[model samples]
Target chain A: MAALDVAPAARRGRPGYDQNSMLEVIVEVFVDRGYDASSLDTIAKRLGLSKSAVYHHFTSKAEMLEIALERVLGELERVFDDAEALDLPAVERIRRIISEAVLVACARQQYLVLLLRLHGNSDVELNAMARRRELTARLSRIFEAARAEGGARDDIDPALAARLTFGLVNSLVEWYRPDGPDEPAALADTVLAFVRSGMLAADGRGPR
Target chain B: MAALDVAPAARRGRPGYDQNSMLEVIVEVFVDRGYDASSLDTIAKRLGLSKSAVYHHFTSKAEMLEIALERVLGELERVFDDAEALDLPAVERIRRIISEAVLVACARQQYLVLLLRLHGNSDVELNAMARRRELTARLSRIFEAARAEGGARDDIDPALAARLTFGLVNSLVEWYRPDGPDEPAALADTVLAFVRSGMLAADGRGPR
Candidate 1:
């Protein structure tokens, strides 16, 4: 599970800037300028507020990152239990997860970009990296189970299959824009269709 | 076609340090510290040379990036024509292209990492981004042909299929160390098998 499964800290926001808006601005700055280049001063100046105003909500830039990533963590960490993912067949489970993943990416694109852009440069980032590894390990087990049950391709290593599946799911963060012409549901459907093409059993068709 | 299709300028290297070795060093640094954090001074210090010495072969960090990306561009641009990729069945063509992509990733790990890490901050990066789009467009065409000929799935849009496939292929930069125990061929095979499953026709067979 993602480390930030619970609600993140720093929910307090000033009058005009609610916690969500502040979080968006913080992540946007981190995205536009590399995480290493963004600073408290930059955030404050962009917000037309004093450093104390920014500090009133979050103690450090690292905290801002944590807040930003928490959104994506919540969305991504719930992939297996999300509404569309509930009660799927083993083969269908793979498709449901990918489809749900695309929707999450579209909804939380900046958070995904920010998380991937980090370089594990600090304690917070190192922890974030470890959390990501944990999520991937959990995913690896699902692929293992699907293959073991004859619901998925057995030729490749489970770990590799997991990475390939997540790669297709996660790469959407790079190009999928919420306001873009493509709708999230259809995107999920298409992505699942393509990835499912590769994950089917050798004899053809889903486990059913 | 890739912008770096032609021989990259400035391959001259000092005695004891061939052009290939220098290129490796430059790309490794770019991969390790990222293009933004890697300064000329840092490269000089890492290479045990003066700033001017680092400058002797390349004028700026941008030039170093260009030179480094060229290696990967060359490998990828040739995937369609590489011995293993040529004269394959429509469905097998997809397999071969994915295989070639994995090998290219293994051989040019640093260069691939550097290319993916770019942020389009400078003209060099903007061009790199454009080149990547062009290559993806070419891959899109291949997917279109395959789907049209009933070699691949036709339900999803060809462009999205190409992106999903390449996303699986290109995300190798985040992992897949060359020194790792997994052989490139096996990795390619596993990836292709997974992808091919969902691409088969309703009756459950490839183009063959």
Candidate 2:
């Protein structure tokens, strides 16, 4: 749920560049320099175009941010929908979801990074956060169901457990580099194992 | 291992403000506005002062960042030292360390937020990361030792366990508010229970 502004009648479709390509370039610049510091002029220059060329496609910086975020949110929401539909056991559904999420993060890494790092500066960001909260609520319900079915531990508070799971997943933005030594599938396994079994010994035989 | 720039030469004596109070103000700004967006002028303005007044206390933004990071790191290192000296059983020590970490997070929340939100933008930030790496390594060793002593699971990877523990603790910055509903002790207990027992049912079930 991102806000998109319509360009002025004079500027709409008057771009020297393709609107879609220009949006892609803007997304790249936003990820590179952060949303606040990245300027339209810098983005235009990087694309070998003029500032007017950039303005023809998007009305302002906020418009670009919303478009980029919309792309990410659409993809993420799709994955969650797929996970929700899987006709498997809860653990299996979760595993499949985790694997798919890793692939999504790797494939759409920049957009996902931007989505995860939103600092809530503007009304658009506030709107995005509300969408995020709604999604979080849905995920939390899934976790609750899984726990109710005895897939997750009843010992841990479901709300806290849900938050911890999401946190572990989100922290991937901080360290999971696509070019790093680990392959995406392998990285997913490592992450999955950590989330499932934790760091302690399986036999509960680790040192104090 | 944060670099401490000496207070500016002109600020050696004057008295109305000094390095510590200035740091307090800086931390507040950092927590309020994401670090990259906060300027020296903003910090000064928040203090009802001028740019010179801010500069008098610190040479640049990096200096403020270093001091803010050091406040948290210094406390972290001390906690590790204290945990190491305790003669308690390994499981108890682990619980104590986790509890202490949550308390540290609650008390020095801003500095801890700064520590947790590093984006790897500079050498200083990278160095801070290196420090975190070393701390994680040390904690991993402790967990490994505890595992060896048969207090934890033998099948779990020590490194992943440590990261999960870290993930749980670090996630506190993202959501936990000191003035929030949960009590610190209660939150710590929830975390400890989850880490020990895990998200699975007592029957060791997988998601469904």
User: After TM-score superposition, what is the CA distance of residue B67 in candidate 1 from its true location, in Å?
Assistant: 1.1
lDDT for every model? 0.71, 0.72
Model 1 misplacement above 4 A: A1-15, A37-57, A80-96, A199-208, B1-15, B80-93, B198-208
lDDT of 2 at B72: 85
Candidate 2 lDDT, tens digit per residue, A6-120? 5555443434567777777777787766676677788978877678866777888888888887877787778789989878667666666667776777767778767766778
**CAPRI docking class of candidate 1:** acceptable
Score candidate 2 by DockQ: 0.27
State, as a TM-score between 0 and 1, how close model 1 is to the true structure: 0.81
- Error (Å) of candidate 1 at residue A48 is 4.9
Per-prediction DockQ comes to 0.25, 0.27
**Steric clashes per prediction:** 7, 28
